[model samples]
Target chain A: MTAPAAAPPFHRPGDLGEALRLLAAHPEAVPVAGGTDLMVAVNYRLTRPAAMLDLTRIGELRAWSDAGDAIRIGSGVPYTRIVAELATVLPGLAAAARTVGSPQIRNRGTLGGNLATASPAGDGHPPLLATGADIEIASTRGTRTVPVAAFFTGPKRSVLQPGELITSVIVPKAAGPQQFLKVGTRNAMVIAVCSLAVALDLETRRLGTGIGSAGPTPLTAPEADLIELPWTRPGLFNDALAEEFGRRVAAAARPIDDVRGTAAYRRHALAVCAARALRRVWTAAHGTESTR
Target chain B: MKVEMRIDGEAAVADVDRPGESLLSTLRDRLGLYGTKNACEQGECGSCTVLLDGDPVCSCLVATAQCEGREVKTVVGAVPRPVRDAFIACGAVQCGFCTPGLLVSVADLLAREGDPRDPVIREALAGNLCRCTGYEKIIDAVHAAAEAMADEAHRAPARSRAAGSTEETP
Candidate 1:
């Protein structure tokens, strides 16, 4: 019988540069932030890496900056901090963060960790996709950015290269009303059965849609994006149009039968969440216009 | 691997046997600070909750070495009095297995919010699961603790009560 791989070497780099150097030197080192996902993997013996790069001590990755039109949230910034500090600017993301695990999980789980985990069911993905966010990835070689929509390659997978560490998530400021809702069996601390995020850019008349846990990876709905909204119309909302948009968003899912939910239930839940999210965002955006 | 951190304002060092030991294991095994419970070694259970630099987190998910030079407040040395008293008064203790972690989490919550409402209290305790109580009494304990603390604050805002002095029923 084969023996288990030896426990991975551990490094606690204090800065991003040092972390990048360690990652570059040891490409197989799994970067751990908050340990919300990675620690679970380690505990379950699901993943055994050659080394573990601890990013908790990196002060640079915990500071968010106002980057002109967008916010550059440091990869190590906890969900609790994001909810407390950035809720106004990144409402959808903050809303999603609020629904994550619980007080303790939110206190520790970082957005970068969520993005790195790349779970189809990760609560952070839908909001990032809805806001047209970009992920800033770094290595000793240099740094590069990937659009959030294009970052996920498959289930629990991303475009992150070996030796690269996620530095920050560049989330565009919410331009209009945004709504995020997740369906779950319990009220809190439960993973989403399925989730949806909708953001409407009133000025551009563009609708952004994100669906979670219904696909191979966190998915965005292109057809739903192109849906026609009659901003100039008297009532400003078409129930049938919104319902059709929900259907289109549901069509985008490649759901599978998982323990949390069946594909058919996921599809149904996605459609409901999609339609409700659309109506909520549209109404809210229009409310802003009328109040103005 | 030797991991060093301050627990409840005192420095502690754990000479860990496993190369990748969790802070939970280090606390429960090496240092014998079993106040942080150890059910569901994964991040799911809040039984191993502790304050990492004033923020409550599951110790099971924290790698021991990563806590170097940081501050941790487990239920052992940092138990809050009002929360503990209120837990007993409200009969919140059921199996008693979830008490220590629940106390730590509630202390953190009450520190953040003095008078948390039902929904807020419910939201705060959601991570610390109790199969026996079904959460109603736990919610009551949070309210009672908040009220008691608030009244104490009015009476003596400057009073500095020592933490962890109240005997916890094991």
Candidate 2:
């Protein structure tokens, strides 16, 4: 309560329609979801908007629906719900969610807040990014789906306009062999030094790994050498590819030396996370135990 | 913002300034429920643990607005008699800073988990940071509490049946 002298005026909309109406009228109003990340910013006076558009009462943005081919998660859905219900859909994400903060943080923090905050170390980012998620942004004009790849502009920045609201995130049904891993300071309640999420396609023999905290935005390795290929003996691609993947992950990350960790440590952790993710994916695909 | 809560079996409503303020602040400042201590404003420390609708949650992390119409029980609510007796017998109350939160958190665990193993107890209370007693006494207190509760549950039916159909043995 001792945050700042004057808090901004808050506007609580009862439904999505009223929320959209407020956003349409006041372009300067900031959308407050969860307030986990925003509270820190507000306390520090990083960015102060005149008004807050509250989304807690909007039922439309809090419901998740699976429509045969894809699952549309309302942006307001907390990570706890995702971990409990959607584990099989994306196991790696569930694993990562278990690592997010303590239970209370997971209970209150939403995937929408993670994306909107756009922190490089956000646990929700790499999993959603690797799953080929699409964000639906709504305004009075209309609603449009934007690919997650193009959603982030930089550290703590996104492609959303002032009057736009991220309504939901849609993940396609075809995602396969998903795995997420992160190394932090502790078992729980610690932000990631580096995190990675990998999804493998069994039929196409293609793999994608999204790495976070080593970059400004979530970094994706779209065309990694598939470990699912049938091979009998050791080859040059066997040992070297993992090292290459590590280097690629390091190259993709634009990490900085912060209080939590150093840039060098982040690079090292990113490589480890990326290589371990690949090994886990390979094991899941082949039904074999990973040596790593 | 108005926060209506069933606190310790009593209906209470409080008008708060910021809806986004944490429940830890609300309990301490507005409702004057100081049983939940504020150690870490973040969720790392379980000092602010309170039962939200019968589930143990860090009151410091949950927004006050979310507590509206929910049942919130603070440490002022009696620690289950078994747990309190165990804590006393095991000498778990040194400074007793973490006692309230630990008691509430452990009470919820015992109620839900039905006397978990020692390892499970450690894992369950991992979020709660206890600086005193070196944790051995606390663990002892928890185990004793669980055993006592189990004993009481076993004896309850016999006591009830004996009380109901007892013929007067003049």
Candidate 3:
């Protein structure tokens, strides 16, 4: 076991402004929330910052508001709250949250933390991508909102600048039925090897697919035109259409071979997950189970 | 840094010198609360489970600085007598490293939901990893504890009623 390094100065800002000011003053300081992922890096001496800014104390960053246009989730909101409170409003996100590590991990792990880590395997990403969420960022200068698609540049990297902090995520309410599915080695406490989320927009007659753990970053499949169906009608999905959508989703993936799984296996898993999610969403929309 | 918090219902202050020091380290090394075992520090195992502000969290993942002004209850403080006795009665304490965390987790579950079914019990203790006893005995212990606690609740009112009648007669 590695002995922990010497203690560095720690700061806990009471407000978002103070946090930003602290960040500006110490660009070397790292921001920590829940500390589930960051602490792991710290424990292994992977990266040592001169100081740490604790964001859990900021009260405004711990709330969620429904603004009619979008549901704004504060970055500090833990996964447990999302699973418990927002299941009906954001079922896809709730489903992903339910698959996170464990009860203890869920209680401390936040969506903001997951975004900050930006691991391709992050379960929070696919749901956010599927919902077309926006990332709200803040610094001492000001705040800006970026689309989730534009946020990630690579694995464990994002467009977030120094001294900037993620404040909240703006997720649009589902236009129709949506579903998230993940494949892992174990039933619980495991990271997703590959995951997929599918959403159907009844008004637009379009389908959205988000793939995870099978690419350098969370990916969105190109919009697939839904088969012509009554705008008001549900249950338009069929075996052929679902299979085509799944194949497109799998084609968008650029997975690499790793210890957990092979690239071929991930592509295969992504196809299955995409198909399963589409079927589930179809069943949900129609209020009837799919026979095939 | 000087970190202060309420641990096991007692005020505790420890000088945490390491930047990456965890609440589990502070509890075990500084405060001598060895009941909260530290098996896997990566949060993979729940050996270091503790209640922070009435919620179960992996203490190993929680920094000592984060615990300032918070209330922490280890297994010694969180586990009730009935639950502890039930674990022993059901032979659930093999090796005993995972017992502290399992006890704390079960206590929290029982407090929130009385007499959870087997699936509920399994899900509640999913974070805790026990290499021995295969978890059947632990589930039995949780059931036994719930029954024992229910029995006590049933008898308390009756005993109080009997005492009231005797006092009235006298």
Candidate 4:
């Protein structure tokens, strides 16, 4: 007599087509990949869906393949595999994956789940932003690719539409060294206070910086200085420039005070992380001071 | 919903009656396999840890229906004798609440990684938390188990094969 009469149907689709059809039919369904986030909500009674679209059985969603100039990582690929398999190419993302949670969580938690949850503190977001990754989203109707920077609309919110599922993410292979750094109360299994990811492309002389936790959404610094940084010139990648990059990256965030950290703390931490990340990537991409 | 799966090297079908019940609850309440603990319904704690098709995952976070036709190995029949002996020898069981999960996790580590260093051991056990916080002893047990298993492998290839076959049983 207390709870609603609707017992949600559990649809475990074995393939992408079946999953998309289920989503199309039950657009109100909550799509679950790794069940890392959805199961928590189910356990806590946070959200009661009309139906549950389980995407784990879809084999295509659990694989990665090579796109033209990039690697298309399936949305359902677990973090453990990324850390093990993609480290050489997606070094920044792999670093973030290593810092995600414990070994168990990494075995189950996924990048697509993080993006679908769209938490401001999702570790995968920063690296995707830094690598200029594109999110490939799909539905029964069609599919579309959105840049990771345009994916999030707000905290725990995304541009994902009704009946849509994240299929994969396309990240350009690391043309140069990449680095990701995070600040937490303690290292293991802690939510990010703030995190930063930096990628410098030697071929294109492009520098990308992403900020996490200290923002309404995972964001890019987008400063003209960062865009105009002389990445090819090793001497220019000094502490002063890196510090300014850190400051601008911090400024780009629209952080609010929360249980994990205060807004001021997040801003300060982001700046420090960003500066250190820049120096790390610069050194890895170019050379040590002695070598240069 | 009735799910048919291989649990602990046995074929069985479990009846899941709840709307959103986890594999942990189904195992404890329906199937009566209570070796896995039920703390922290969230995936943060590894108390309800089980091997879902040989990969350690929080059973509390797994839908019972989704485990259909897949393998699930829990602490009851999965933990090797040497691992348990090492745990007892090292005094890793304090209060005994987190032991089963820790045992399963440690067994997994020993099986997958024959020799793990201190940091790797710590990182592997990071998800399983002991409220009693006897982590030093647990680390000692993991090292001891690894060495014992290696010794067993060295001593009798046949016994080691049997253990491996039992774990890898389809």
DockQ of each: 0.54, 0.28, 0.58, 0.57
Show model 3 residue runs off by greater than 4 Å.
A1-8, A223-236, B158-170
* Pairs with backbone N, CA or C atoms under 3 Å apart (clashes), candidate 1: none
- Model 3, A45-162: lDDT tens per residue? 7877568888889998888999796789999999999999988888889889998998899999999999988899999999898878999999989999999989899998999888
lDDT of 4 by residue, B1-170 (tens): 67898999999898766546788988898889989999998888799889989999999888887888899999986799999999999999889988999999998998889999999999999899897855999999999999998888798988778989999997
**Which residue pairs in candidate 2 collide?**
A92-A180, A214-A253
The whole-model lDDT of each prediction reads: 0.86, 0.76, 0.86, 0.86
Question: If you assessed candidate 1 against the hidden native complex, which CAPRI class would it receive?
Answer: medium
How do all models score by TM-score? Answer: 0.93, 0.85, 0.93, 0.93
What are the candidates' interface root-mean-square deviations? 2.0, 3.5, 1.6, 1.8
Residue range A166-261, candidate 4, lDDT tens digits: 999999999888889988876688889889888888888888888888878888888822545654466665777777887888788888899988
> Comparing candidate 2 with candidate 3, which one achieves the higher DockQ?
3
Q: Which 10-residue window in model 4 chain B sums to the lowest lDDT?
A: B12-21
- DockQ score of candidate 1? 0.54
Ranking by DockQ: 3, 4, 1, 2
TM-score of chain B of each: 0.89, 0.90, 0.91, 0.90
- Least lDDT summed over 10 consecutive residues: which range in candidate 2 chain B? B161-170
lDDT of 3 at A9: 77
